[model samples]
Target: MKQQVRELFPTPLWVLDIPPSDAAPFNAKLRDEIEKIISPRPNVPSGSNWQTPHDLHTRPAFADFTKLVEISARSVAQFLNVERYPMMITGCWANINPPSAYHPTHNHPNNYLSGVYYVAVPEAGPDLIFQDPRPSLIMPWTGKLSPLTANASAEQAVPGRMIIFPSWLRHHVPSNEGTSERISISFNLMFRNFAETAASPRWKATAGQE
Candidate 1:
């Protein structure tokens, strides 16, 4: 007898890893530029991380980063067969998570794609976790947890690594257990002129026809 299992409606998470040789200098440059913008970083309440202004994409200093984001976003759009429709960055910012600081669960709304690029991570390496969006996944488990059985998935943070996923996928960063701080940049992408281009009705009425 032959048996098979079919997986349906799988979520896509794209991981882009930069070679260490190039990433070393690239990440150093990014870290320096980030510090310049948020020098004397504003203090945040306990358990919260400091975030830079949400307009890095417009800053002249971040022009290279903005171009990188656009290229990456285009790659994603091409994968989904939507390359013809232009996608623009809606928001771009840096997140500085000091020791013990953490981010609560949240999702990017009104955006097509969202991603995080790690600039600096502690030696221990924390995780970026994505929560399962299906609301009815209340089932019991006993043995090891596989992809299908797990409710949440984790992507380890590494310098020069970029993880992209659907904008509406809920995710969060756990407390920074490592001694050093964790720095990353988060951004969102959405189709340009979405309402005018892609939001129109998919089906049009057939005049004078059944």
Candidate 2:
């Protein structure tokens, strides 16, 4: 006898890769701009990473990058069939994670989506781990890891690669075990005029025949 398995409630993760020829110079420019903003970087705990202000999208130096993000976000909105409401970047920042530095597991609140773009990665790249959001999972231990058995997924960081996912998805960056620091930019997007447009009820009431 044979039976079918029905998978439901899947999560969405969008990955976009830029051509190396174009990404090379583009990343170089971004690296320079990021370094300028974070020079004399603030001190942090041994395991913590340095982060730039969350307003990078508003800076003239990052206008091009911001535009790229907007274009990509529109594609995501279209895929999700929610293109009617406009999406805007609420926060954009760069992360400079030195050797042994890492980010804790967290989620972006009050936003519809979040993403990260890698500008620089060490010879031995770091991993971005996204945890399963279902708290009641009772999956049994398996000798090997597979999509059905894994509670978390690790995405390898590579320069010129951008990853986008739901803002509420919990994720974290592993420690930079490489000899050099790892550089990346992260951002969040939300529906514009959220309160006035997107938050209203979606149901339509029908009056009974009198």
Candidate 3:
């Protein structure tokens, strides 16, 4: 007899590393551009020291960065073998987490994919922690086990690194203990519908007539 094993329902997490040479300058330029036009908004649901309004993707200054993010998102969709429709960025925003600032566990809603790109991360910046989405699987837990039964995982943030995951996954960031701010740009992507595009012209005409 031969031994057999199988693994099911694996989650996908993609990480893209941008060379330090390119990342260092790009991050500095982006930080300056963000400060010039966007004002910090209070009471952000994601829990940041400061968060920009969720319209960064529409700004002219972010045009190049937006293109890069879209490329990365497309790669993720391709890896998942999703070829039915084109994926596009629905929104983008920035978060500046100062010391002791943290984000509570939450997931992006109404989007197929979500991601974050590190613009600036201090040496001791907090890690990005993810929780297992399936809660029922743990009902039979008898005792703390090893990697085979682990329910949560953490990834350290690196400057210029990009991470993409399913929007439904629950994840959060721990408190930033470093002196400097941990800056990151987050975005969401969704599939585009042909019907929506076809109706745009008619909608425009109707609005003009009204």
lDDT of each: 0.91, 0.92, 0.83
Whole-model lDDT for model 2 versus the true structure?
Answer: 0.92
The true-versus-predicted C-alpha distance at residue 127 of model 1, in Å, is 0.6
Return the TM-score for each candidate structure: 0.94, 0.93, 0.82
State in Å the error of residue 160, model 1. 0.3
Question: C-alpha displacement of 189 in model 2, angstroms?
Answer: 0.4
- Would you list the rank order by TM-score, best first? 1, 2, 3
Q: Look at candidate 3 and give me any clashing residue pairs.
A: none
Which residue pairs show collisions in model 1? none
User: lDDT at 103 for candidate 3?
Assistant: 87
Per-residue lDDT tens digits for candidate 2, residues 1-210, read: 899999898899999888989889999999999989988778887888988999999999999899989999999999999999999999999999999999999999999999999999998778899999878688888899877888999998889999999999999998888988899999999998989987787878779833
Query: Which residue window of length 10 is worst by lDDT in model 2?
Result: 201-210
Error of 2 at 186 (Å): 0.5
Give candidate 1's error at residue 4 in angstroms: 4.6
Clashing pairs in 2: none
Top-scoring candidate (lDDT): 2
Give lDDT tens digits, candidate 1, residues 37-154: 8888677786779899999999988898888888888888889999988999999999999988999999999999999999999987779999998886775795878778789999
